[model samples]
Target chain A: MGVVVTSPQFKDNARQAMADAPLQRALGHVRKNFIERRAAAAAGLPEFEALRDSARDIKNHTLAHLDLYLEEWERKVLAAGGHVHWARNAAEANRAIVDICKARGAKTVTKGKSMISEEIGLNDALAAAGVAAIETDLGEYIIQLRGEHPSHIIAPAVHLNKDQVESDFRRVHTHLPKERDLAEPTALLAEARAVLRQKFIEADVGITGANFLVAETGSSVIVTNEGNGDLTQTLPKVHVVIASIEKITPTMEDVAQLLRVLARSATGQEMSVYTTFSTGPRRPGDPDGPQEYHVVVLDNGRSSMLGGDFEDMLRCIRCGACMNHCPVYHAVGGHAYGWVYPGPMGSVLTPTLIGVDKAGHLPNASTFCGRCESVCPVRIPLPKMMRHWREREFERNLSPAALRSGLKLWAFFARRPALYRLATRLSTKALHLMGRTKGRFAKMPLASGWTDHRDLAAPQADTFQALWKQRRETR
Target chain B: MTARDDILANIRRARGVAGGEAPRRAAVEERLARAPTGIIPARARGDAAHRLALFRARVEAASASFATVADAAAAPDEIARYLRDANLPATLRMGADPRLAALPWAGTAIEIARGASDGHDLNAVSFAFAGIAETGTLALVSGPDNPTTLNFLPDNHIVLIEAADVVADMETVWARLRERFGKGALPRVLNLVTGPSRSADIEQTLLLGAHGPRRLHVVLVGAGEIGRQD
Candidate 1:
């Protein structure tokens, strides 16, 4: 992957993340805010749950008819005097955008927050071609200054604290006075606005990611809380939209259904502050808008996901609710996942984009508490998908020798119910007798991983299956 | 094969269907033409008073401010009053919208500038195409009448929402767009703004006014008892 991925080092990264005090402190905010706000927003709308069903159905229908819808969207875009460039992968997508900038003689380009842009490493590509790319989103700008990728999807700099951001601003913004009061997020935001505002006016090309692409009107929709996306696409002469193929929806009404669940699940807003729909470049007699419009639709392994076990993943609207509620994500924060995406969604998707051999550890990191799927707006079975990755890893002999032996040992007993039940009963009886006084073990013979952190309760004389059978017969 | 052809071929190969299947073609065409409205929130369907109340509540909830006026003639005065109250400049930038140009700006002390923003103006105003009650969103179409720049590139933005145009839900707004602009077609841009700009990038603390307007003030004109689907 052109985007430098440490996903293969996820285990080591997660270990280091748990020990980093500053990151741990920053992640506390995610724990406090997203869950309660989303709960309140979802509860406020009586139709919210029903709307999720509608959203899921719409995406399902779109994915089933992806070819026809893409054709219709392309035809409509051409009719609207817009150009559509097809990209088979990240390299093609980046080339299409850079070529557009080169044709327009664009020295600088302003960018809205786009995970696809990050996935394709667009900034590095643009730099290689001698074009400057300025990130206009406040979080993206902060991360761009720090030379970091986004830790979280929606909140790019969520892994950063106020002091870290303040320092970043001081380091980059040299023209400002040294002793000025840059002590607050508010001040940091104001400084970013002033800085990016200049870039927006000077930039010759604007690039943004589409939240959804409407096939009916050939429009690309962007939902943002800050108005950065609006300015990014509006002020520049050339506007280039980079989006994946799965973002296509059949109609505006279908988009409306998805929009209802998107904001509430992401940031707990009824609607994001700005939802702008752009069909093409500036129209005849239009006073202001982009003079030229181009859309770069990227495949990048998504078509393979369409009719496979992971087809449900395409229904995701990138709400970030999964990571927000994921316990493992909360412990290590988003950076430990070490890719453009993080948390439960990343666990499943990473293995697909990059091979399971590289990102196999991500799936095993989950505790499978099911909070992600329960809160998912489109109801993608994230944990189930992760399990699928784990199974595939085992089948491909990618698992370690010890783990393989342990699983094999368990599978042997699992196939023989009578012997397994007798063996478990004898082991439980022996453990119960040995630990009668303590009632728990700080260490076990074969399981040091569980006992390392906390004590393990000793099993009773009878197994749960035996106890259940006795209770039913007694009743 | 071209990238488009390869992608379509891959999708068809996985989906187990050729691209020319009549049933799939008819399904997509039907959905596009009919544009069926999905589940609308219960809060969206209400009486005139309830609609206005919910609109105000949701707008305020989004951290935006709105003032009600009896008619369009009072809109400029409202903008002037809002600027004065917020300790902002009394100057305003706007486009050539006939509805706003016809407003009685001479009745107020505010100075007015016209044309698109080059990122220099501190304040601007625009006429909205419709006001949505479900989310308290103002949908504005792109044109010389109401330049898109006035909507985003300003420190302060004041929008005029005609009460008669305020609708019950987003679905209503979609229906109106189809009727006015024609099915499967729209203006180059249609902006739906719900609140002032904000970001929660630093430590998950949400602060209003990021890159767009620091303050968004809406002048809801003739808002009393003016509600209907049509």
Candidate 2:
């Protein structure tokens, strides 16, 4: 893979991310904006919850018969004169796309904001192959100029402020007038639009990610607010779509159901500015569209997710709701997750796609607040999936020795309920006697991880079990 | 094994089924053939006039401007008025749509251009295939009639939507598409445009005109009611 997996260093990354003032300023936007907007959009539509259920059922049905649907989708794509290339993993997927671009003698390629492309490390692969890849999405363009991955899935540069973007543009785009005023977000958008417009025309190949691959019509759908995706795919001679295997929906009606909830959940828009469904290459007498249409479907360990507890994860539509509503994500921004995906969805998915060892910290980061599952458009049980990852980590002995022994010790006491109550009673009494004056512990043995960040409140005179038993007896 | 075969085999194994299991295949085939409809929002359901009003309201709420013209003949005057109001140039780019071609451009001083956009035009117009009232979406099919480039490569995108073509929901739009294009066949591109180009990526601040038309002005011909901007 071209992109480095910093997932193993997530704890350190999250530590640094927390201390970065500018990043914290940017993350504040997520904490305040997305939640209110989403609530308003959902409140406006009475059928929003029912539509979420429909979206979930459609995905469930499609996955249950995925093999069949995939075959059918491939047949329809071929019938429409489009090529479908299957990749077992990221490397193969990149190779297929690079070869397609190389065969067309492409020098520069334009790209819409596609998380799958980032997942497969396509831009780096293209750069190594001597092909320039230009990002067209406004947020993606900002991050690309700064040489960074997207902090958020939908809003790529959500971690950046306008000043940072202005500096990045000034630093990289020396061709433009040096004294150009980019004080406002609109000015930066206009500059990016003007710069990328030329690239859109000059590029030989264009690549995009598919939100849904309709099996009935053999079309790939992309939803965008800025219309960059349309420009990316329509301007180039060859349009290459990079999508995961689970992106397929059964029909256009299913696509309709999914789109109804996608924008509302992600950006709180009734609909995005552009939702394009591309069937194949430009037809005869068509004025403008790509001459070659290719779809590279990457499995990348997703097929293995089926028939397992992680199967619910495959229903995810990448709406960014889970991350937006996640308190942990708000506290430390997306870069702290240290991978392509960063939130509740990423916590469960990262472990499966990469390994639990590299991404074990992600699932453990959640507080189990359940806000993600509540806001999830497809109703993916994010916390449950994270617990599944924790179980897998324990099964593989991937967690730290200290945690394993702690859990092991707890399990031993739990098996003997009387002993558990006795041990807890003694510990509560000792803690109460020691910390009754302070009412909280600023420092504590064996719990420095908590005390280092915030004071751990002192235990009461009795444990919760003791209190519950006494209350029941009194009642 | 080839990537395709291996992926399929792995999925089948994971699901504990062989390829072409009769029940599974039948289920998929039936779904594909049936194209079942899910729960559509009640907001899009109403009389045609109410639906058109809803379309206008939603479209305007998305930061797009909407206007009503008496008929296709009045479209040119409305288009000219919009360009003048926005202070854009009198030049307009379009594709070879006969519906738009039949309009009397000679009555106005606006300069008309045709074919795909090469990223230089400031204003472009296209005819929408259908307008969904549920979300105020405009569906434009890519062909000689309406080049896909005009939909994105202009500063001001003016879409001409006929009142008769407006639908109650997206599901109805699908039915219309299937009838026009036939099952399992589609035009090279079918674009569903709602509002003008916008992004909230910069510190979560909403800004318009990011890589597409900053202004989306829809001329709803034969639709009497004007939409209110939220």
Candidate 3:
């Protein structure tokens, strides 16, 4: 899909999405299904918390020493007979990939599911260069056909329903019978498979994302439920792996720890159906594999995060667990977050990558529910991190002046316990008087955003601070 | 050699501030120290056999194959029979495994190709040194007998299992693997195959044959012996 899924310009698109009742209903169904499935998977494992901690430790340790691991990983990969390239950012990454394809005179490029590639807008770049970039992941292919950005990290088209898919298929596949039935999921799947199989066989360059880079062996681990990742990595003569630099681990044991948590958190599977680890190019006696292997490691604002307070953010394995559990993400989905990554991770990551000016509103989207933090396998304090970003945005003059002024005034009063207590008491009394009977405001002046969709209840006459004072005096 | 050294050097550069490595003996000792000193907690509830059976049932439910064998000695013959039943070629490029040397299957007339060289050969038999009952996974460590290619290249894969090696959970497997190989050692490949190679790439149709083995056969020798042997 195009990169416009939930641009900062998404208020208008979100309004449009809200207006479409059917689309909202479809998203609701999908949200509930994933939420329930994730809960069930988590409930079944007694060691889930322990696993998460271990996974977090592994990731943190790797990221903490990422440079070392990456260098070692590249060495092993090269030793295994693979070539490595470094890209400073998205443009460089895209250029390197396109150049490789051009060098090969590649006409068709098949891709596995890689959010990094999406972040770099690789397909559009390839297409602009007159190369055909086909997304082989079923969900990815569907979104690609619709010319939209992925709405979810793991399930890219989670926002689209069967009917919408049927419509897209019919619109695109003009060669199909005019009276063809697109109602069945199976039928839709069959159609997609038919269309993709031809592309897989004909593709000249295959590109994929690496789940983990093993420093000990120089292997790129790709875990997929569908074998498409294997095809995308092996079928074509040239295989290009576009992965974030943070994906490296020191050893297979470290990879194992991460793998244990990844699938269980993402789709609730003990392990994904396929976990293929490719080491270097095809060996001398090998058969039916890529002849050339190129791994492009993209830094893209990640290196800056090292040894910083946001260092914990690099521990993310892109499992999409935090997004799956986030309430705001469930309501608005990935597009609402407005970047390559979404959910709690996206809220923190997007602002860092694109700068707060472009994503000033993203960090404010959360309700501080703590569910994202609780569910994050890497233990990233996502809510706190977002707040940190918000603070940075304000300090850098990225936030609107009014918001900064209001926050400054609030902080001033909050620091003075007496003034804070007095102000809250007065505000509560005023709110109570405004809604004496209903005890709720329909549209408060300063809280139109909160009251637009739902009512905000007035606080009790006596505040907690006031009650505490009374109790202490009586004692 | 320089490439390897360069990689190590880069790592040293990246880890500019060395987080002092805990002594190897101390690390192991620390773990032991943390172990319960009192009466060990009651053995985790449920029969080991039942847990394994239930796990196998779950794996099958997820569309994977599972088998239990009495020992590694019987792996080759069971694998031979499975390949024969599938009507696959008898000449199998197999992974390197010292255990296969003891399997007296000369009468089976099956040709065995061994080592990493066999990775891309379409027909091969591979032995998982261990199987995780929790996920129905076969852990194939690269050695003389277990070649990395045997796990990745073959269109039809036969994984032999020893009942004694089945672990109840992934954590236990990790602990054991680490204890055996240390932190720095790694096999060329450590394939954890849960099922036959399958893909839903073509419009999510769930095609069984994509890149890896189209069929997976597990030769479970003695269904009742896993818990008892371990």
What local lDDT does model 2 show for residue A423?
93
> Lowest summed lDDT over 10 consecutive residues: which window, candidate 2 chain A?
A1-10
Please identify model 1 stretches exceeding 4 Å from their true place: A469-475, B225-230
Best by DockQ: 2
* Alpha-carbon shift of residue A195 in model 2 (angstroms): 0.7
lDDT of residue B218 for candidate 2? 88
Screening candidate 2 with a backbone cut-off below 3 angstroms (N, C-alpha, C), the clashing residue pairs are none
- Model 1 chain B TM at 0.95
Local distance difference test, per candidate? 0.91, 0.91, 0.71
- Quote the positional error of residue A377 for candidate 1 in Å: 0.7
In order of appearance, the predictions have TM-scores of 0.98, 0.98, 0.79
CAPRI-style docking class of model 3 based on DockQ: incorrect
Instruction: State the displacement of the C-alpha of residue A393, model 2, in Å, after optimal TM-score superposition.
Output: 1.3
List A-chain TM-scores for all predictions.
0.98, 0.97, 0.94
lDDT of 1 by residue, A433-467 (tens): 98888999998877888999999898887899999
Tens digits of lDDT, candidate 1, B1-230: 99989999999999999999899999988898888888877876767777877787777777888898898898888888899999988899999999989999999999899999888899999999999998889999999989999999989989989877889988888889988999889899999999999998888889999999988998799975433222
Residues B7-71 of candidate 2: C-alpha lDDT, one tens digit per residue? 99999999999977788888888888888898987877778878888888888887899899988
